[model samples]
Target chain A: MKTDWKFILQIFLSFLKIGPATFGGGYAMIPMIEREVVDKKKWIRNKDVTEIFAIAESVPGAIAINSATFIGYRLAGVRGAVAAMVGVLLPTFIIVVILSMLFLIVKDNPHIESAFIAIRATIVALIVYAAYKIGMTAVYDKTTLGIATVTTAILFFLHVHPVVVIISGIFTGMVAVQIKSWFGMSIKLEKDELNVVKKEKQVKEA
Target chain B: MDVLVELFLTFLMIGFVSFGGGYAMIPVIEIEVSNHGWMTTQEFTDVIAIAGMSPGPIATNSAIFVGYKTAELPGAIVSALAMVIPSLLIILIIATFFFRFNENKFVKSAFYGLRPIITGLIVYAAIKFAITNNVIGELSWHTASLMIIFGLSLFSLIKLRLHPLFVIALSGFVGMVLY
Candidate 1:
C-alpha cells in the first residue's frame, strides 16, 4: 500500500514487460496479464481479473492499457496508473515508430509497394473478420440485429460522424430498454460476453 | 507545434469514444486521418497493415504511426499519450468512486445499444477500407489478385485459425510475387 517511486517503477516495469506481448488484440492478452498480475505478482486476486477486464473493455481505450492502468491504480495511485500506462505504451510506441520510420524510407520501393498493396487487401479482410466475430456476439436478438443494420445503413448513407453514432447508440439502448421494460419484455446487454468470459476462464484453468 | 496540439486533441477525442476497443476505433480514425489530410487513404491502409502486423493494439499502433507521419517523434509521443490518457483518467475515476460500475443497470442498458453499434462501426470500417483500397471496385488483374488475397486471408483467419501476423506475412509474400 506504499506509494513510492520504487513501487511506481515496479508497476511500470511489470507492465513494460507485458507490453510487447499484446500482439494480436486485447482479448488474447487477458490470460497473459492474469498470469503476471494474479498468479505471479499477486498484485490482485484471480477473482478480480475478470472484473477488471470487463470494466476495462467497457471503458474507452485498449483493454490491455485500461486493465494495466486499473491494476496499477489499485496497487498504488495516480502515479502508478501513469507509470503502468506509459509502461504499456513505451514498447509498442518504440516498435511502431521504428516500423513507421522504416516504412517511410522503403515505402517507395517497387517491391515494398507491391508487398503493401497486398498487405492492404489483407488488412481489409482482417477488419471484415473482426466485424464478423463481433457481429456474432453483438447481433443476437431482433432488436440488436436491427440496431446493427440501422447503424451500418446510417453510416453508409448518412455519412455521419462515428462519435455521433456511438452517442446515439447509447441513448437508443437506454430508451429501447425502457420501452421494452414497459412492454414487459426482457432485454439482455452483451449476452455472449459472459459466456465468452466463462469459456476463457475455463480454458485458462484447463 | 500546432500539429502536435492537433495530434494530441484529435487522438484525445478518439480516446474518449473508443468503446469496444481497437477495431471499433478504426472507422473513427480513418475519418479523422482523411479530414486532416495527414495521409492518403492508401497510406492510411498501409498504416493499418503495419499496425496489424505489430505487437500492440491496432488503434494505438496506428495512432503512433499517424503521429509520426504528421510531425515526427514528438507527434508520436503526444498522440500515444493522448490515446491512453482517457483510459487512465476514466479508470482512475471509476475505480475510486464507482466500484461496481459495470454492474450499474443503466450502463448495462447503454452497452446493449453500444455493443451492436460497435459491430456496425467495424463493419463500416471494412467496407470503407475495401472501397478506398479498390477492393470493392472494378475488376482488373490487380483488383482480382487483391480479392484473391482477401479471400485466402479471411479463410485462414476464420477456418485455419492462423495468427494475423502469419497471415499478413504470407499475404505480403503473395503480394510480392503477384505484383
Candidate 2:
C-alpha cells in the first residue's frame, strides 16, 4: 500500500467519525469500523477486521482506539497508528475533559450536590444493571452460575484482588469443561447471541 | 508533576487489569483512587457516573476524570496516555509476531473464568457503593426519592432499552427537578 500523509489523514478522519458513536464501549463500533475500512476505504480486507478486533481486546486500552491503531499501523506504520489513535480518542477526550471541569465547578454547589445525591442512588441501580447485562452472557450453565455466585461472595467478604477472582473464574471454566466432557453432560456454554468478533471476546474487554 | 506521574502509574496498572472491560475495572479503581486519597469511595462513584454518561470506555473516561481532578488538563493527558500506552505497545508487538493469539487455551480459559468474575465484581461494587454512599442508612423521605430514581434508572437500562448516556442524562434532570 502507498504511504502518504493524505492516506493517514483519511484513516484519522475515518476513525474520528467512528469515535463519537462508540458509546457503551469500543466494541460496538466494530461494524462501523469494518464498513469504513474494508468496504469504503479498502484499507484492509474483511478478515483483518476480526484479527485486529481480537488483538484490540487482548491489549490494554479501549478496543476502539486499539483497533484503529492496528489498522493505522497496517497502513502507514507508527505515524498512522498515532494518528488513528488520536482521531478515535479525540472526541472522547474533549468531552470528558470538559465534563470534568464542569463537574468540579458544579459539584460543590448546594443544588448540584443535592442532584448528585439522587444521581448517586440511581448510579447504584446502573451498576446493578451492568452486572445484569454481563450476567446474561457469563452465566451459561449451572457450573458457571456457581462460579459467579462464589466469586461474588468471595469478593464481597474477603476483599482480595480481583485478579485472583478472574484467574479462578478461568480455572472454573476449564474445570467445568473437563467435567462435562468426562461425564458426557449435555450442558453447553452458549455465549450471548453476540458474535465473538464484535463482542468483547474479540472487542470490548477494556 | 509528581501527581501526574502518580496518576500515570496508577492508571497504567489499572489498564492491564481491566481485561474484562469497563465495569470490571471499578473495584480496582476504587482501591487505587481511595488508597491514594485521590477520591473517596463515594466520590469515585461520581466519577463512574460521569464516565458512564460520557462517550468511550469507562476505564478511559475514569482515567481522564481522575487525571483532571488531580492536576488539570496536563494531568488528564498523561493519565490517559498511561492508561492506553500499554495497549498500544502490546498490540504493536503482537502485530509483528502473532496473527492468531486468541487461539491459545490458556488465554481462553482465563477469559472464561474472567467473565463471571467480572460480573461479580461489578455487582459487588454496586452493593458497596449503596452502603457507603448512604443509599440505605436513614430511610428518610429524601431516600425514597433516591430509590424512585434508582428504579427508573434500572428499568430504563434493563427493560426499556434506553441508551445509558440518555438514561444518565435523564436521571440528572430528574434529580435536579426533585432534589
Alpha-carbon lDDT, every model = 0.87, 0.79
Candidate 2 contains a number of clashing pairs equal to 4
- Cα deviation in Å at residue B41, candidate 2? 1.5
* Candidate 1 whole-model C-alpha lDDT, 0 to 1: 0.87
The CAPRI classification for model 2 reads as medium
Q: Write the per-residue lDDT of candidate 2 for residues B60-174, one digit (tens) a residue.
A: 9988998899889998999888887877777777777755666566555556667777888888888888887677668888767777788888898888989877887777778
What's the CA error at residue A5 for candidate 1, in Å?
1.8
DockQ values of all predictions: 0.85, 0.65
The sequence of per-residue lDDT tens digits that candidate 2 reaches over residues A120-180 is 8878987898799778877776676777788878988988777667656667767766777
Instruction: Tell me the deviation in Å of residue B158 in model 2.
Output: 1.2
Q: TM-scores of all models? A: 0.97, 0.88
